[model samples]
Target chain A: MIDLQEMILEKDRLIPLLRKLKKESRLIAPVTNKHGDTLLSEINNIDRDTIDLDRQPQNSLKSFFLPQQEILAHYSVDTTGYNFTAPEAAKETIYFGVRSCDLTALLYMDLIFSKPAKDASYYDRRNRSVIITLGCNDPFANCFCEATNSGPYLDYGYDLQFIDLGSSYYVAAGRRKGADLLNKWDYFFRTVEEEDQKIRYQLFLEARGRFNRNIQVSHACHKLQEEEVAETIWEKLAGRCYDCGGCAYVCPTCTCFSVDDMAIDDSHGTRIRSWDACTSSGFTRMAGNHNPTDRTRHALKQRFLHKLKYDYQKHGKASCTGCGRCVDICFGGVDITTFIEMFTRDAS
Target chain B: MNTNFIPATAVIREIIRENDTISTFRLELINKRVPFSFRSGQFCMLSVPHCGEAAISISSAPNALPLFDLSIRNAGELTNAMHQMKAGEQVGIRGPFGTPFPMADFANSDMLFVAGGIGLAPLKSVIDHCLFQSGLEADAVANITLLYGSRSPSEVAFTTAISSWKEQGIDCRLTVDAGDDSWHANVGLVTELLQKELITKNTKSLICGPPVMIRFVIARLTEMGCASHDIFTTLERHMKCGMGTCGHCHLDGKLVCVDGPVFSLEQLQTMDVMELGT
Candidate 1:
């Protein structure tokens, strides 16, 4: 056993250590662009880009693993007959500065795509990646990961988890890949001291207390299981929803997608899978123009119920990681937290 | 890694045009890998060259092993494109997916089939399976009856199959919504054919039709003393992946693609499905 489990790295050694890791694999970290927004971007050069670990990235780890619109297979239609060839295998990459809630949602994605059969394209990208999550010391404004029990600091499901402790970082390796990374760059880190352990626990407690929103996620889940939400509640939510599909795009755990074939020429084209929102009428609209769900009353019904009610009953854990990205993204005031508040209130 | 979405090519052997809008395409897998088998009420995701895919029911019984029938109506882009395809042309086929009707339980019971327009596609699979079972099993399906209703006299499909069933002594009664000069049969909804004698608890009423007809037929059958679990019907949804992943066929907590394309009336009672009055 390597015993490369817990160690401390000085704050100054972060960039140089990432530069070393970048040489072997493609390094993706939260980088602050010129427009003043932090995003998880590929680092062209180690020191040239501004890798901001302080702010939460505008996007989750979804698009990196499951691109917005990726070609699943390329097909050629001619005299030879219709045949399809898969897209190229994913490149080996290191994902750095991900939040605990984001990584929690990735674990949920793993559960979703592996059913009747494994989604080939999703697995191709998911298998070749190393995830390094940054524990939220100072939680983001919209973050309710504390309520969801997915964050501030996660106990599991990350390759490597980093906790900022003043001048140094407390790094814990949750998997063999993370242990190898620690062993490979041993000089950048030092042994964890007794004082380091005390401060880490103290910071964890502080982070837990810092969350402003106390969403009744489990209460809502329970209420949904027992009785259906009042039709007026659904109507209120659906009435305000503009059907922009922005929340689903921003949400880390909403893994629903649609597959369609597009043509490049008369002979060849590609089969593509794109993100789909259950709120949209087109998500369930058949070819004959028959839609089972009336978008007026049921637009937000599927979205809320799937995460809180149905998924909870099926998985014993709700799909909502309480990242609260949807809370910030939805301008219509119909976020998951709003529904949960209304549901729990009405049920109580 | 890529075989998940890649559909195997199947050649269309024959196309039986039933009416102006409906046609039954007999397809055989060119490669015949492992020998594809599907129970009655299971469907396949058929792919057209330019068009993506649509979930269509396998209207044929398992006894027709290597060959299966897909009774498609000209309802959508892929279906319209399929209507234009000729015999000997190849099309992509993936899966014989979703839950199947429990033929073992049904083998001992009498069968009553109610169908409307293209809704007859999946019920036709069950009806034929019951007929096929009667020939094989010594304790076979006791009695069989089909009450099919079409939009009009011209819209009545599977006339050839209906004639064959009548010769085999199965009571095949049909009705049409609109009557023509040549039409000599009863003109009314198929629900009117629901005689009190046929609504026995032991008789499994398999229904597939328009949502409205299914609603009315089920109401009458239940009122006439048929048990909820004994009344089974297959559902049609806008499905992309015939597997459970795609959220298209999501009815309540259950995915219709996997949990069912075939659900009993008792099962339907729990869900807030649109097929019912809800």
Candidate 2:
């Protein structure tokens, strides 16, 4: 049998293939809503609604696994005694048209939740889902995933990676699930011709040259380890921060969260966890109104350092995936790229 | 999503009101699977009914388990709900997490514990453990000294524990910020009491309390020729998940949940620690 590791799917057959896949499992893809913003959402009507993979989806795939807010457990203090039941198991899902940077961020989330012990809720959703990444053929204006080693095209980490080649698509399978899909649906794919490999390589080279920003990500990571950022630099960033929390919320790798119990009534409650940002005033505030970190000057200090220095030391790579969403979201021009530029700039 | 945050059930065996605002909850794990054993500085996420969890240190010695004590101050929502909790009621527990104090290194060393307010709860664990080991082990602590402080005489907690430690031939010095009519002990900062103590080469100073108290006491100890490596302390921070996922306890490059709640002064040397003001 021929090894079908890579194949070509005609652009005309993409919709028909997705329709077949949607019948068995829940299908999620990028869709432009009524407000004209494209987000990765579930397709209720595969035939009617147009799937929009042309734009950079403003949101990442973080919420699907580690949701913005989720119920961790349900508890009750009744006559039967206090007890808790873990949330139910997750349904099998097929995530199509996922950007390469977002899938990379999900992989980072997998590592964070696994250590100490695997977070039960996050893994339930993550393990049951299949990831099909849509590699960027043309990097966006703010995109710098090249520096972060995540995208405009990735070498690995996707179950299936699909690259656009004008009239058709070049699909490469990296994992077992992806390889299984190609064998199951062999009718929709063609054997890789010699011309397909040449075109894929040609497009990959063009995508690398298209990145507009050359962020010194590794330089900043190394510089932070050797020397401290000036106090004046911290003050400059913190001064512009309005505490909107948009940067952390938009960040795919900003996996920090807060756990609390929400009461339904007197005896019943649910323990929940919600996404929390280090930039907020209340992130580190303890009981008795005792806040250790002075937010006036040190608000953005821990966040940048944790992303650049701490995670780099632990994981051998910085956590900032350079999706450039934070670069676009921050109105104050105080995104991580700004910090890296300022910190790595040579000072005589 | 019955997730991992589900805490095992615990029954409140007793509640001793330490002061107007502080109480010691004596708890026993009612769950069968939780093989609970912890070191002195490790903390547990205490969950009360209708209220969320809070990271509180385990106060009693491990020899006291399966019964342990969680000394709390009525400073916030969860702790206030905890103060209203009755004995025989049930609460939830998540941990026995964090890097515990270096008990292996404590053998044959002179142990000096300095505490303030509710901070004495964690140090009491190490102190009582040392006392218990003296009954069985040959290389037990050489001696134990306690310098505890409170805001006022009425605000003083752990009076019964202090009396017991004093009766057992341990040197326990009590200090208060303000003097009352019946107050006759040292009426100054806890640092003043530390001033009279002799710091030798083998003394291991373990400190816990408010941030300001820790700063001043460490300064005094360092001036008295105590090496930074020989001095150890546990740092407190806002905590959520006890398993290092939550970002509340981020200190410098370390997560207090993982890297430490307990660290030597040398380990904290160049780190930006809130407790030591480094």
lDDT of model 1 at position A101: 90
TM-score of each predicted structure versus truth: 0.98, 0.98
Give a tens-digit lDDT track for model 1, residues B116-156.
Answer: 99888898888888887787766478889899999899899
lDDT of candidate 2 over A1-348, digit per residue (tens): 324399899999999999999998999999988898999999999887768989988999998988999889988989978888877788899999999999999989999999788998888888888899999988888999989989988788888999998888899998888888888998999988998889888999999999899999999998888888988889999999999999999999999999888889888988888999999999999998898899999889988999899999999999988899999999999999988998888462
Q: Each candidate: what lDDT?
A: 0.89, 0.90
User: Which candidate ranks first by lDDT, i.e. highest?
Assistant: 2
Alpha-carbon error at B105 in model 1, in Å?
Answer: 0.6
**Which parts of model 1 have CA positions greater than 4 angstroms off?**
A1-4
Computed on C-alpha atoms, the DockQ of candidate 2 is 0.78
lDDT score at residue B130, model 1, on the 0-100 scale? 82
Clashing pairs in 1: none
